[model samples]
Target chain A: MVLKVGILGGANIANKISRAINSIPDVAQVVVVGSREASKAAAFIERNKLVHASPVAGYDAVLDFPGVEAVYIPLPTALHVEWVQKAASKGLHIVLEKPIAIEDEHVDAIVKAAADANVVLFDGTMWMHHPRTAAMEAALQEIGPVWDVDSAFTFKGSADFLENNVRVKADGDPLGALGDVGWYCVRAILWAYDFTPPTHVAAHHGALFNEAGVPLNIAATLLFPGGRKARFLAAFDTVFTSKLEVYGDRGSLRLRDFVIPTAEHEASFVVATANGLADGDTRIATVEETRTVRNAVTQEAALWQRFAREIEVVRAGGRAPEYWPRIAALTERVLSAVLASARQGCALLPFEHRA
Target chain B: MVLKVGILGGANIANKISRAINSIPDVAQVVVVGSREASKAAAFIERNKLVHASPVAGYDAVLDFPGVEAVYIPLPTALHVEWVQKAASKGLHIVLEKPIAIEDEHVDAIVKAAADANVVLFDGTMWMHHPRTAAMEAALQEIGPVWDVDSAFTFKGSADFLENNVRVKADGDPLGALGDVGWYCVRAILWAYDFTPPTHVAAHHGALFNEAGVPLNIAATLLFPGGRKARFLAAFDTVFTSKLEVYGDRGSLRLRDFVIPTAEHEASFVVATANGLADGDTRIATVEETRTVRNAVTQEAALWQRFAREIEVVRAGGRAPEYWPRIAALTERVLSAVLASARQGCALLPFEHRA
Candidate 1:
């Protein structure tokens, strides 16, 4: 059965998700495209050659659409939690394009709504499902235990975006650039380290400015438990660059262009052995399995399908409802601390996230 | 008359200083080289074709030389304070290389000795004296009011150094690899922001590994006051890379290679302006300034000579002897807090240097 998907905004991310849905096999079908501006929604539908497009005059209209099983939210950062909570209250599954909310309180409401309704709610973190990320994680396992990780994702963007975009203006905090990009980086480190979130967290926050004298770049460091740590550099006013390194006890894994890349497939591994602790020494390793990966968007759609299966099983009383709330709460907790550290200009120690 | 410079050890930095002294005009003369191992000092003297070379036991004889006016102490990190104090008490001018001393207590005694003896004490912070650094700072005036600055310097060595070197040997408390290269980065940021050290400091520390899975790699962050901050990364078991970036309101100046570059010269800067903010178009006005710096070591030596002159003038009633004592005390206080923050895994609040 095809799971019908509706887009609630005419933004770039929604358009990309819509395109990806069409490519997925028996998964998501783009049913309706809605926007506050009817002409914008019509143009987006016409551009994508979709059949249904409507003005988002009210939330009830999108929720009651025939065959609309899930809503893919691509609103501004400020509206994520409000829309997610509303959709889940109406028994609609949600694929939220993060950071989940402008504040942690909204994430709490969304978590409660999803828990009470027993509905599927997944944050849109497509990179988590990317093939390279999985490969990087598998490579970490080969190295035994991960000891440290370093990451950076920076790009040169306009000063206007830094000072006046949905980030600082709508969210009331300019450090969302770190949240938007650094979240993927932090999660990648956690995933590599077996989903262990930082027990103690510390960070230094600062911004880069453009010719117009506006803050357009930001960077931070996150300390995790058991001595595992991560460093992130997110910029909208510098050169374009992205890279990640995971250093383990036995070896290390390096990923260049961690977030986005357009070059030849380039990756490396360093192993520490009896001889001089491996210093970028190359070695031939055997590949035991051969597999192909779908495009990023298609893979994300597939993960959404997995979310649907989990939701269905739970609704049928085959799975416990407690699990989803924990993950949701954890996500909100981590994201909240990241922003708080940036605001406070110091590390915010992690607190217990009670569901 | 040429200023006779006697190097007390045949260390790596000593060799660099000898070469730099050769390039500068009417400043430094490599008159004598001495070491406990006579052969080591002889080899350095012969390799550099210096005028005199002797064993460490003949320190008094070398100091008695008519031309020996200044002593350049490039001993181990632990010996910085002792040698500087000894040289100052002997009525000889001193050029002390960083970090000055690993411990805060050592700084007070050393600074006092130099003051009482009426001798100049110059910390060999050459990168700040490099022409590109001057250009970067001068460009800051063009960029407008500075908001935030980020700096980094990272390199790789063997795991043995992590355990054996004074840098990571934990003076009283366990000091990670951060105390070595990390100090330079922290000092650079503090100096860039006019020595207003952060009231709060926090850090995330990590390790590479030893045979027994001990820490051999570390990275950390420091929060400074007025929204100024820094992050530093260093390892004894990875690759080598260094970068320093100063982001301002109107633009940013960056030095990709802060130190130890293979090329003859390294460093560059970029200035970007928002077009819309400038009253017209909806595009950014961006400009980049790129240039290669020359003779970083010699530039530092020149700065040292100027500092000597200033110290002489300041001693002639321009400034009180108490002025520099406060500066030295404040620097040590900052270093102590950084060490505490790294060890405790929490923000170390700043305090007045009582001693």
Candidate 2:
């Protein structure tokens, strides 16, 4: 009953997923590892200690493998549309990395192909599957209505990474920091609003670009209906930071580590009650409460578990989950809008979904 | 010798300043209280336990009172220019409440009047005097070049406050939340950048306005020259949150209570080192350090002591302090640009300082 997962690239993230799959032996297993070079794929498997996975000569060989029921694509962003479309044509379930496509049309095509093939699809945003995320979702409901959200994800890239990494190349990953680090910030904001897309998007000025014209640092604001707003920043030149703040009418939720928890087994977020001046006093008094959630499995492993469950449901003659593709599409739409707005001199752009 | 001070307007904030003045009895003393109604001024003196102060019928009376060398003006936003000009003409040192004026022209008039009379002018943003703020400034230098700053200051208004508070009225406090709460966020951003104003400012969409066409909630982004940026949120309809995050190339600094510390005597901020995967490991390791500052005096009392010292220097034939008014004018210029951008449909406005 194990779901056979195939990896399409020898990317660093592929090694992480390979480990995650091996950790959850009851539900899923990595059956094939593919790369442009057979030697590279072999080395990746040997280095990761992926004893059960068989290294293949080319990406197409994994797609054409007889025992592969699903594929995990950690290839460069520019290659996502072609591989995802091909995987969908072969009726393979997909665990795609973020920044799913460089453009919305490609995302639409991949989504339509998956729908046509009746296959399960999920993005590789592992934090969404954590039990702590569920706890945070419940806490938000208790706090009255949320009105504002601020999130950021940043990291300092090494000199070699800036000079040689495919992520900084225009043709390799056109969105650059907007696609790598910014993808998480966009997804986090959308999740906080229950997958509601923004009505308006505006890129802030002062976005830094590389020699080839790909952004290295950027920020944007998303405006939703009813005075709800979110602001996010993404950078490849800053020290590592992952934080999110959700402000409600009656309370607030703040977490210093939202994209990736500081600890694997335990995570915590702070909730503050409405602030006010105490009776006959000028100083404000706000009561803060900390909430924690613990899980033995890593968030990445949990993500694979959920994907395996969805695959099982589809195999048993059930419909593919609509929520997964829906959210993925929304994330791409907002990101595309941000890029367009930034290109047009930081103008306010209307957010429209093709689907 | 004690510097004799006068209180102009019976505003609620005046009560807080009166207490701060009394706490520093060795340097400054309140000699007169002024209001539109003589009876109201007398009642305020008794209610606030200002036993050493005399009540005056009119604001002009406080300015004319003999031996009054300084004045603290806590009048409504619309009345700042008139009282500040009169007090300055009397050669009085002034402690002005924030949101100095509704328009740039008004702020210019006050600055000119103060300069003409050779008076030491200081704004009543008390948190700037906290010892922790100095410590934070030092930490920023250690962290390397700061490129991005995010700050917020929000508080929930009571029902009576929403309906009857002068802050919500167009003719009384006009600037509304942007002038009241947003003033702090703007100042913090400027301070973090060492008083260098942004080259461009843009108001984020989704600003909530009251019935009187004044903002109740608003957010904006400021872009400095070298890809350095700042974003801030100010709201009157949400729980109080005074947070600041500063990101640099080598590290980051974050604090939950930036506008007002959680306690009068102690404050803390967290610093995170640059993250990286440990040698031969896949997990990111970021070290977080907490820093605390303890003080014997409240920030407000410390602010008063500094203002009193500056007055003493001016009284001894020293030149008036230019740094105070210079920073004040820069804060107002950024605030005014935010309002202008919001009014013009979130347009990107150039930040121009008259001073």
For DockQ, the strongest prediction is 2
Per-residue alpha-carbon lDDT of model 2 for B128-195, expressed as tens digits? Answer: 89899999999999888888888888888889998899999999888899999899899999988998
Worst 10 residues of 1 chain A by lDDT: A277-286
In order, candidate lDDTs are: 0.59, 0.86
Superposition-based RMSD of candidate 1 using all C-alpha atoms, in angstroms: 7.9
Candidate 2 residues lying further than 4 Å off, grouped into runs, are A277-282, B275-284
DockQ of each: 0.09, 0.52
For every candidate, give the share of true A-B contacts it also has: 0.07, 0.44
What's the C-alpha lDDT at position A69 in model 1? 75
A297-345 in candidate 1: lDDT tens per residue?
Answer: 4345545666667657755776435554455456556656755655565
Give the alpha carbon lDDT tens digit for every residue of B1-355 in model 1: 5567778877766766776676564655777777776677788887766754444433455555566777887766577676777777777777776666666778778888888887776666666666666676777776555545555554446567655654555342133444456556766676666666565655453434344432355554555555555566655554344556665566656554554333334445454432111112111123555655565444545555565565556446554245444444455566566556655654555544364
